[model samples]
Target: MSAMTSAAPPAGARRGYPLIAAAPPLIAAVVTAAVSAAVWSRLPDRVATHVGGTGEPDGFAHPAVLVTVSVLLLAGWGAGGAWLAGTARVPARALYCGALAPAVLLGYLSPALLLANAAADQAADVRFPMWHLAVAAGAALAAAALALVLPTRPAPEGERGDGAAPRTSTLGLRPGERVVWQRTVHSWLLTALQGAMVIAAVLIAAVGGDTGAWIVLLGGAVILALTTRVRVSAGEFGLALRPALLGVPRLGVPLDRIAAAEVRPTSPLKDLGGWGYRITAGRRGFAVRSGDGLWLELTDGKQYVVVVDDARTAAALLNDLIARRSAHSEG
Candidate 1:
């Protein structure tokens, strides 16, 4: 049996972990609320929520509505970042900075809208100054800088000894034997989400919203094409992952580049910070749902993981192939 433990954080890299998860969004929410309240008396009933290419107001919403949406968006993103930081095998700095930059950008934008609309009689009269873009960009940059200086504790490495040992032995095969293993991994959550997005897009179009509806439709289509399900295959081409719907876009690792392969348990949320395709520090893979996964250790030192059932057979076949290739090269 093999055991896994965390390597200690590099000297001087370890520091006290603060409440960074809630800080950025909470502070941004407070700032937005304060700014909105201060400008309430001077603002028009409607605010320009969307601007066109020339900085003219093209879409409008009630001030209260805009503020509420902004706050929710900020909080939701921050929560996701925080959860990923805590559970996903990713760098904490990247997560914190990623979360803060968007929160700061939206925080500036929410107040900037109110200020732009202040003292205006109608939403159409509001002009979003190009300078506001520069300001928002600068604020996001500033937040990123702050994140760099803030103390961040490294994410804990996952322990491995608790589970059953992965299938590490190569499969016994007759000379000149050939075999192919294939499995389809599906995510019900992604399918449901895709349907919801399409329905929402249709609803928005029915209500006469053009830009937003098209955006939603495009998002749904992209999600469906890339993430609803993946077809995994291990054979002469080595391990591959391709969208079950359309096989054109494929992710593959050649046999020559794989140093080893094995079967291991994995979690979509805990290991990959939610589903779809994911890349972390030294690993990248397709994560549809959590279960047995084919873990490939590449020649370049990076790791690849793809969730699938019956990963043991895949791993055994891969190892046999690797051994055969090595023997052929030696011969």
Candidate 2:
């Protein structure tokens, strides 16, 4: 574990689609129904006549279908956010963002409406705004990029008060054998995953299928897979990595950094704006579940964090890290 320092890693950007974070209950349904109705209204007389409505057709026989579809779509968004939120193991906060990226991307994209409009294209003279679609997707992509980018900083001074470890006469190398333990494979794998996800999204968009939602769904699956993690160590305060599909490492917040942690079963649209490590308007750190370990706050605001699966391992690791830090300072 590294010491908490003024040179700690910088935080990722906090921007995402609100629609995907926590879709407010009635609002999403109502909006879906309204959008459906508005789309229906825009059709030429011929198309509206063909749907075979009564004296007055309300989008469908009723708004039930629209509402149902809205719920399913919102569920998708919530799932994506939750999956991303689940991957916050210490040192892997970026992965958590990757996991929830699709949802964030699709949140403002209005997947349901776009698909429906595309399906109804022949019936209506009007078209859904391509501008809206582009903006939404672009915003999501930006958020995804922010979450995955690794935070790099010059190594902070060791507790012994120097930037490098103390000289050991023993490693058998001359006086100058530097060890650079950069995590190469791990970083590459994550970056490749992001590329794969981008490719998948592009393919869906090009398919010209019923809205480009297939891409979002595919991305969501990748994100979820990235979140499931295992404990790499056992025994003190906490240390574990929640994997991700970006060029970022796992979340590895020491439990000691957590000033407080709480869990709230939030609605897909009601809370948790976008994804990643979110500090709600009320200042609560939300991970998908307590089942997975989450270190919310840092004692010094300089440590990394993760949403890990093994709480005990995290606790033990944190303890060990603190001991090591203390030993160095005392020595």
Worst 10 residues of 1 by lDDT: 5-14
True-structure lDDT of candidate 1: 0.71
How do the residues 230-259 of candidate 1 rate in per-residue lDDT, one tens digit apiece? Answer: 899998689988878788678879989998
In model 2, the number of clashes is 39
- As for candidate 1, its clashing pairs are none
Candidate 2 per-residue lDDT over residues 1-331, each given as its tens digit: 3311122111221223222233432244345556656665543322221122222222321222333345455554454443343322222434435444555554554544434443554434324545655676787777677666745333223212112221111112222222211121122223444554555455445534334455575666567456532223322334334343442464444445544332211221223443334555533332332222223335655323233333323333334445455556699
Off by over 4 Å in 1: 1-165
Off by over 4 Å in 2: 1-243, 249-275, 280-286, 290-292, 301-306
- Return the top candidate by lDDT: 1
- Model 2, CA-based lDDT: 0.38
